[model samples]
Target: MPLLRLIMLALAYLLPLCVWADSIVMVAPRETALTRNFVEALSSRLPTDTFEVRLLSSTPAPDSASLLITLGQEALHWRLRQPIVTPTIATYVTLDGLQQLHDEVRPASVQILLASAKPERQIILAQLLIPRLDTIGLMFSEQQRWQTRFWQAAAIQRGVNLYSRGIPGQDQLPRVLTNVLNQSEVLIGLDDPALYNAENLKTLLLTSYARNRVLIGPSAPFIAAGSLSTTYSSPENMADSVIDMLQETWRPAAIRYPDRFSVLSNQQVARSLGLPPPDDAELMRRIHAQEQSR
Candidate 1:
């Protein structure tokens, strides 16, 4: 029985190695530094003993993968075109972008992690930055018109009036923006690239500045481009959020926004508009308290 005991001990040691771990495939459009960094961050958070993470660029996810994650809109669009059998999570997509894709065709077994901050959070930031703020202006492209209701609801909840204008085409921006600016005290930029891309962002900033109105709520990059303020999540924040979601038991398709975010403000822009910008740390604390209270 000494031989049997040796075999038993060997089996005991090997059995643990034989145990199956869940495999997750993360697909990005291309292997850029940004995508690579995100994958590395996410992988570091997962328990190495229980999870195996793989990053893919243009390769099909193995059928054996327990879960599939699409890193950005391009990767998500590519995945949706295929027959998705694996449970999928899509990140780095704006809520409106996801909605647009969903409208085209309902994706199966997919959960969404919206890249944009919640509308309420943006509205709260705007209110806090602009003293006695009464009315906020918003401009949207034809594709982004649906977002107006969300912004309106958030504005109403914060007891501020919303003045929204729709631009059917870029040609209509000058006219539409003038009307929106004329009626509202401050303009809020949405995450829609069609309405707020580099080509037109300068115009928007210059026009708003000339009118002595502040622009808020665009992505973090726009803060340097003269947007007064915005709330944004970092790569680490996104990775932490994804790790938390993975730890939970599987559920039906659900949508989640980043629980952790950072507030960005341009003091120069605020000063230009004659509004005092609150300290970012203090502003973040107030925002957290407001969110918790609700």
Candidate 2:
């Protein structure tokens, strides 16, 4: 009888241990290089027993997962369509995309690791690059008015002026660009393609140079195309954000930009503007120090 009782107690203990091993479901829409890199970085940070990656189309997740980490917007869309009660953490999604989803879903446990850097981060980096900077210009479509307002408020709090314009259509680009660049020392680009499409980016960069205005943007390509600098997060930084999210209690569904960032600068562009360019290492250190001081 004592042997029977011992066997039942052992079964009860092992059951929860087995269940805990399969508590996480990591989903990605496709098997692309970016997805692979994110998964690799994330795996290195999280323990093997903590989570498992699965292809969104092929794998059926367990009935209940403690956490659902979606790699991109498509995976997030797929997961939201299902009857999932588990908390979701989305990576590589833009703030605009995440906000649209939030408006539609009004989900409680959904969170995002936004692709773009926060406005404060951009403002600080721009100030570092151009110490005399007082006014920053931004061009966005009417759909992004909310974002513009958010940036404007953030800039005002830091004692900087935000000269932002809402373009109604592509036809107003030249006129609006000329007007804003005239008053602003730096032009910061958002993730909006309406303002920075392939056809318009060259002209925009050229216009900023003509006005002696430094252009700080979100993508590395902007630096390659003669912008002074860009602020973006790396895959490793994203892994750290995810780890932080998992350790906390779920919050309201919202887009959260990365706390850590990498800044890229074009030395040739800086030289052409007669501005001294700081080395990447020194620039990063200064930014980190400023962030810590704040």
Candidate 3:
């Protein structure tokens, strides 16, 4: 909640008479540590071709920026229908802003995927795994214990083992990972700092392979390391896309799901794990497709 009263420090760079650049104001409901960090990142990293940015302090009046990015649900509610702006949007994921400007309707599964970030990666992995395989195992344990949700009636209806270490964190992670690999075929890398922080990927995954197990998670960085496969996304891809939509015109108010998680695997990784390595042509095509979509 530290960024709540943030004033537009960068707006001064934007000049009047609609200067050569488009000025954009970013609004978030509260002054969160994460929000402040993002503002810093955006100011330095946002594409210069189309934008200049301002920070709005929850004041209702619209100021400069050609487009305003409202972060989080609170901002979404207040800004979208402001007697001034129309249907901005509500992006619950990234927990970034609540602009009434979102106009894309995404699948429920995709929404869950978007909402699942570094901390709650396990939850997202559970959603994807519980529906596809039984006896899914947590390589390490921490914030989200899968048993709670997976044990529910709906989950029971689906039927799968929601296994865990019972004892989680740095001390027990390696053995726990070993145990989970023994108990199940597929492993979920939940991004718990205690387990994933300093562990090198090649060794951890090779250990799973020795036990004849597979691994999957949301980081593109992992796939290259030796895990059987992984799903990938970058903040910049989504951020730039949203900025472009807001600048051009008004559309539907909805969540735009990431197209698909990138799948990464090598012949050795795939073969030993029982997955046929995806055609290199297909992989290249998919990567190209993502570039074109952007």
Single out the weakest 10-residue window by summed lDDT for candidate 3: 106-115
TM-score-sorted candidate list, best first: 2, 1, 3
Candidate 1 lDDT by residue in tens digits, 1-294: 266544543343333212322676788777777777887788787656544444444457776665678888887787678764556778898966776775556443677788987788888888888779999999998888888888989988889999998999898998899889999988888878898999998789888888888888578899887788888887887888777666564444677787777898889877777777659888888887998898
Question: Whose lDDT is higher: candidate 1's or candidate 3's?
Answer: 1
Per-residue lDDT, model 1, residue 8, is: 42
Deviation in angstroms for 272 in model 1? 2.4
For every candidate, C-alpha RMSD to the true structure in Å: 7.6, 6.1, 10.9
lDDT to native, each model: 0.77, 0.77, 0.47
Q: How many clashes does each candidate structure show, in the order listed?
A: 0, 0, 27
Q: Report the C-alpha displacement of residue 213, candidate 2, in angstroms.
A: 1.1
State the local distance difference test value for candidate 3.
0.47
TM-score per candidate, chains pooled: 0.84, 0.87, 0.49
